[model samples]
Each structure stands twice: as structure tokens, then as C-alpha cells.
Target: MINYSCINQLKTLKDIIRYTTTIFNESDIFFGHGSDNAYDEAVYLILHALNLPDDNLDMFLDANITKNEIRKILYLINKRVTLRIPISYLTEESLLQGYKFYIDKNVIVPRSPISELIQNCLYPWVKNPESITSILDLCTGSGCLAILSALAFQESMLTATDISVEALKIAKKNINYYNLQNRITTINSNLFDDIPIHQYDIIICNPPYVNTQSLNKLPKEYLHEPMIALDGGNDGMDIIKKILKNVKNFLKKEGILVLEIGNEYNNFVKNFQNINPTWVTTINTEKSIMLLNQEQIP
Candidate 1:
């Protein structure tokens, strides 16, 4: 039988995992009435404290963990359980399109489903895609989309534009991290301000689309992210509308624009009652992403 006193002062990886599981169960009561997977969150905290790679937990499931490590992990777990802070902020990293990008409060966590479309190269719509020589990622927070674009389309030149200087700083770090400085250029601009007037073959955006009403309802964990990246005015399509109106000027005749409007799809359609007939909509499990060809715009 395990001694309760000794268990409380765990010294091995095994001990820490066990303790974390226990604390997670106890903490769940505080998280909410019927929360599931609270233990997973606790385990993440443990892995973080150890500075362990994401797969390390699986590799060392039975390995011993030190007592001091248990204490530190427990403290972080408590902070998350009590404060409702997102684990991403604590970890300073997030995954997108199977690639890891460094993250902090300076930029929103990378969680766009647009990754799926990108991975497949926007098939069915983008035939003879060699024509896509230049691509633009507007509102390119953290530069995840831009970096991923370079990785996706090796032959294309990429430009990532953002309005926030702080966001641009984080994006630059990611660009440098991926060593994509040669293929990717970071610009500080509100939409198309700094972007060249020349046409682009593709423009991808996951812009701010959260309406004020929805913003007020966001969980505390979401509040930890940058509001400038989330709030999309009263109807949430303020930025989307602006982009739709001005995007035609920057696109080649055959270029396509892909826009991610999270949770604001209905409002978007309502605002733009006569959406371009050439525009096609793809609904991911989480949201609706619209694609419009340059020729369809005007």
C-alpha cells in the first residue's frame, strides 16, 4: 500500500503523474459540475514543468519524477484550475496544421481549421495551381498561416500583413524560427495598407470576426488572448466586410481569397446579402470559410 504521507511528497515521474491525477480529480469540482478531461489538463501542466516534449509523457509514462518537480507542477495546475487561464498561454506554444508555433498573450493561439484546406492545396478550386506565384496572408497573427503557406507552396512568394505591431513582432519571431525569411515577408499594415497594389494569386485571412455581443460571452480563458485579435465590432463582420470590399484590387484576375469567419457566418451572409455568385463556401467542423475568385469579385 502507498503511504499517504510519502505520496504527497512524490519524487519520481510516476509519482508526479499519480499526484497530478489526484489533484486534477479534486480540482475538477472547482472547474465545474460535470467537467471531463480535467486530468489531461493537469498532465499537460506536469509535462510543461518538466519542459518535456509533448511525446515525452508517453515515452516516460513509467519513469520516476522528482518530488520538487511534483510541487512545481501542482502549483501550475492549481493556478490553471483556480484562475481559468488557458494552458496555451502557460505553455507559450500552440499547434497548427501539425506544426508547432511559439505563442504568448501577444498573439492568439493558432487554432484555425483553415489548416486542412491549406494542407490539401485548396483542391477542386485551384486547378493548374502552378499559376499561383504570389500569396498574401492578411491579419497574419503570429505568421502561422504565412509560414505554413511557404511550407505548403514552395514555389510561391509569401507576404504576411497585420495591423498590430505587437502581433507583427510575434509573427516575425515565428518567421525566423521557421527560417522562412527568404520566402516570407512580414508587413505592418491594416489590411492592405503596406501590401503592394500588385495582384496576388491567393489571399488567405483569419481575421477578427467576434461580435461585441459574443465577445461579452467569451469564457475567461479566451479573455486572456488579445482582444484586438478577437473583437469584430457589433456584427462581427466589420473587418470581413472591409476585406471583401477592398480585396478585389489586390488579386490577380484568377486569384482566390479565402476568409475565415468564425461563428459569424450567418451575420456575414446577412450583411453581404448579395455575396459574389462565384464565391464558394466551405464549412469546417467549427466554422464557415469562404473562398472567392478575383474574377468573381467585380
Candidate 2:
């Protein structure tokens, strides 16, 4: 409900950025989709709405904003605050490790710390990235990881699998956008159900590991993502457990499984006491993602 007066108050890009930040800070909005704070998110939204490059805000700060543009940006901000929609969903795009991909409500936003590990090509663990020939990205919503894997392991081929047909559509869209159709393929599968019994050199998954209790307490923004992409049953291990059970069948003898269970580390330890996994430490956390070798699964 932006009126003429409110619109009148914001005339320049800086004004909109300031006002948007103030309102965002004043409101109870969450900010995990991309930016971590109000000011950053505001600048990003303003730059994006203006069709300006997102990286440079100071360059366009004093530029005057027209009334029509102001209304458009204001409407975007209002929807973000009122509906709690993630900015990526609002903008129809997402970034993972600086690589951009088209995004929509059908898929969860790509925020996996695995992107960091991928950028490093699994490094010490995967001593020979060049030797890796096949990769599998499970629960690959929007196919961002599959695309990243293709870029990182240029010599390797990949298969991105998802249970939801709608989600697979987005994944394929991204895969095609990156012009990796020949290297990566999409499969409609309930985990391993429909996937061919081909083994992979690496299998990475940022599956739904939000426990029931945590899912119940998720911010409104998370509710906008598909429940199947977050709800991991009572212990946040429903999908994880299934993944572990069948992983051995799809992984090469020397291959590895990289799983992101997020805060479910404690639950994982409790449930899978027999299997030991190495936690991948991002600059952010030590417990977000875990790695396991083929022998570790059985």
C-alpha cells in the first residue's frame, strides 16, 4: 500500500536503500536467503530492482529514482516484508559460489556450504580432481550443485536427481543455461529408486535434514520452500537415513559421499553411531556438511 506521500519521500536510489533498510530492521524479517543484514539486503534489492549490477552500489547511490521505479521497488520490498518471501524468490535468481542460476518457488534457494568445498575441488580428500569421472548430486534442487560440480570437475560427468518433477524442471533449466547438457543429466527419482544403478566417483547431497521440531519453528521465509526439501521427519534424518542405506549401491569403491545435514550433526551422531564421517569445515561452521567413503556406509 505505498501511497503518493511515501513514494514522494523516496526520490533517489540511496533514499530507497535507506528507507528499505530502516523498515527491514524495524520489522521482524529474516535474512538467510543471501544477505545477512538489512543494509546489505536493501542495497541488493535496490540494485537488482534498478537493473543495476548488484556488486556496485556506491556507483549509483545519488542517482535519482523515478516515481514509477520507486513504486516498483517499493512494491518489491513490501512483498518481501509482508509475505516473508526470500529475496531470491522475489528476484527469480540465486547465486552459489558466485555462479548464478535461475530460481523460483518450485525449488529451494541454493545456500549450501558445499559450494565452498566444490570451489576447492574437494582438494586433499579428492587428490585427483582430473581423475574423477562421474558425480551424482542428490536432492539437487534447481540443479545448482550439479552445475557447480560440472564446472569444478570439468573432466567428470554428473547426474542430478530429485523426487519432484517440478524441481527437476528447474534443475534441467539451470544445467542447460550452463551449456552442460552433454555432461549432466536429470533423473526423476525418489532418491535411488529411479536412478540407474551406475556408480559415481562423488555423490553430494544437501538433502532435507530439518528435524520436525526445527521445521515447526522455521521462519516464514522457509515455509515458502518445498516441505519435501526441508522436512526430514522427527530426527532430521529421514532422508539422510535413506541416503545412507542405499548409497553403497551407487558409489564406487574409491568414491565419497558429501552430505549436508546442517544442525542435525548431533542427531546424525546418535542415529548412525557405527558410521564415522569427516565434517567439512566451511568458514562458517564445522558441522554443516559431512563426508564419507564407500567403505564407511556399510
- Model 1 regions more than 4 Å off: 1-11, 18-36, 56-58, 276-287
Q: What is the clash tally of candidate 1?
A: 7
> Against the true structure, what is each candidate's TM-score?
0.88, 0.97
lDDT of 2 at 176: 86
In Å, residue 127's CA in model 1 sits off its true spot by 2.6
Q: Can you write out model 2's per-residue Cα lDDT over 29-142, one digit (the tens) per residue?
A: 898998799998888787888899976777888989999999888899889988999999999998789989999999999999999999999998999889999999999999
Q: Which residue runs does candidate 2 get wrong by more than 4 Å? A: 1-4
Best by TM-score: 2
Per-residue lDDT, model 2, residue 145, is 88
Q: What is the lDDT of residue 22 in candidate 1?
A: 78
Instruction: Mark the 10 consecutive residues where model 2 has the least summed lDDT.
Output: 1-10
